[model samples]
Target: MSEPRLSSLRWRVTVRRHPSAFLLAVQLLSLVLYPLFDEMRGGRVVFGAFGVLALALAVWVVNRSPAIKWIAWLLAVPAFGFSLLSVLFASESLLVLSSALEAAVYFYAAGSLIAYMMSDHRVTSDELFAAGATFTLLAWGFAYVFVVCQAWYPGSFTGALNPGQPRSWLELLSLSFTNLSAVGLGDVIPLGSTARVLVMLEQLAGVGYLAAVVSRLIGLTLLRHERR
Candidate 1:
């Protein structure tokens, strides 16, 4: 094949065979990119576009799993549409709607990955990748939930730099990661009852995920080796 055709074929094969790796890569890359772009003027538009890309990749990852692809599409279509509309029109209501839908989609994707990893006795390379991808998905989903909470109840979170001021997306995301990882190092603190409740739930989820999913994978891997 020609060079162009070869490159296209490789790209397609990678997406087909290792979609979870791509999803995980994009999510991690965003952690670095988000902070850099956020300080610049007109950064919100770029942030919105980046969100749409991540959602699209999530849909792709979900489709590769044993998930019902249509369900992911159903949630993602409106999520990204509302996301773009909010960016274009600067509508607060649309942004809230989009964030909610996006959170739902991410949760669904994470569930699908869990199901995929637990479905069979044998562990595949994709399943291994899915494990990490699922964690990031949960973190992103919870971040979106924080976004909605902040919108509904202003001053939901406080940070060291701007106490009582509305938290930025990066700050919220950092909070989510710290909470979900049980790090307890985030500067953002939940002030409202609603936010505190959500944070507690995410902390439980983080512990349960490690106890359940991680343990199961390790046990299964040991069993597979014993059988071999």
Candidate 2:
């Protein structure tokens, strides 16, 4: 009876793996899918709904997958806030808001999934590598939008983009990512007080969340090696 019960659990895990992999692929696709958005209104709607959906699915997966708890699935809070802001503002604010929130989701989601893959030795190196590659692509895409925002509409870009000062294009993209990761590098000055506060919050979330991910991975490695 015990053997059969264990087999059932194993089979369930095997079945879920494929679906989980597919979800991860689609979630990654949604990142670039935003830039291709038909129009501003449509983009905002798609971005908000898709982001919210991804986080919702993440909530489910993180709860069931004990391996990812290290990344503290609770970090999805900021990502959720970004989506809400995008839906509410749904104007010039939507681009910055949606981008930031999506970045947060991918960061946490990808990081948590990495921890999950690492802990589950059954997961293939190829699959894990593919996940990492996809994440890098997502990161670069966000970084690109941040750049183009400042480039095409220097006076028009909203949110973290400073309308007042003459910051370099690299500086602006860096700021976007810094804000996306919630990392506030003091060297690049904030255009407004609100942007400053937001930057601080982003930096906290970014560093704290990544720390959680790394800590989990290291702990698991230690345990695995110790047994060996």
Candidate 3:
């Protein structure tokens, strides 16, 4: 009844009504912020925090069974903690493990969201947002994969702005999205066999995903029209 209570109630309603929009906003913001900061110490911390928030929002937005929900929470909490610890200690092993876990979380969450959207007979704006979010998350996941590979084998990627230096996450992210979109600008080149294989796989995936999503959206639109 009070003003504060009213504000809290309104906030809760908005979240409940537009969870996908909120998740998409967080995904976009992280995509921007994660690349902007360059300081190693602070950058990792910010990245860790962003990972936690993004995964949390993703899990919340997707509709899941109780068992799947529990599993998501189980994986997400430890992934977040490990990420923070890896940053704090500056441990390469821990960071690699954290990146693996984070990648798993995002992959699972994105798959679940996509599955949900596909299963639903009626499509909404939220479904469209979820699709975009899933695509972006996939890019982020692969970027971390590139990071891990680079860590394991130095000089895995070349042609970055700082040539001959270890590539930053931001640079990798830029490369990942560019590769995922099949832009192939050639500014960033993957040198190692492993890196090249990963890039090729990502390019195939990007093309396949676009095809699938476009087909599904069109099918859904046709179905809606037929029902009228």
Candidate 3 lDDT score relative to the true structure: 0.78
What 10-residue stretch in candidate 1 is worst by lDDT? 40-49
Error of 3 at 184 (Å): 2.0
Estimate every model's Cα lDDT from 0 to 1: 0.82, 0.50, 0.78
lDDT of 1 by residue, 14-65 (tens): 8778778878888788777887887754354355546546656656654654
Tell me which of candidates 2 and 3 scores higher on lDDT: 3
Query: Where does model 3 exceed 4 Å of error?
Result: 222-228
Give all TM-scores, in the order shown: 0.90, 0.44, 0.90
The regions of model 2 sitting more than 4 angstroms off are 1-15, 18-23, 64-176, 180-189
lDDT of candidate 3 over 1-228, digit per residue (tens): 999999999988877776767777887877667646765574854565577666766676566578787777877788777777887787888788777777777777777877877786778877877778778878887887888899888999987477898877777888999999887765778999999999999898889888887568778888898989
Residues 63-140, model 2: lDDT tens digits:
475544434344445545655665667654654555555555555555555555556644343344434433442443
| Candidate 2 or 1, higher TM-score | 1
Order the candidates by lDDT, highest first: 1, 3, 2
Instruction: Quote the lDDT for 160 in model 3.
Output: 43
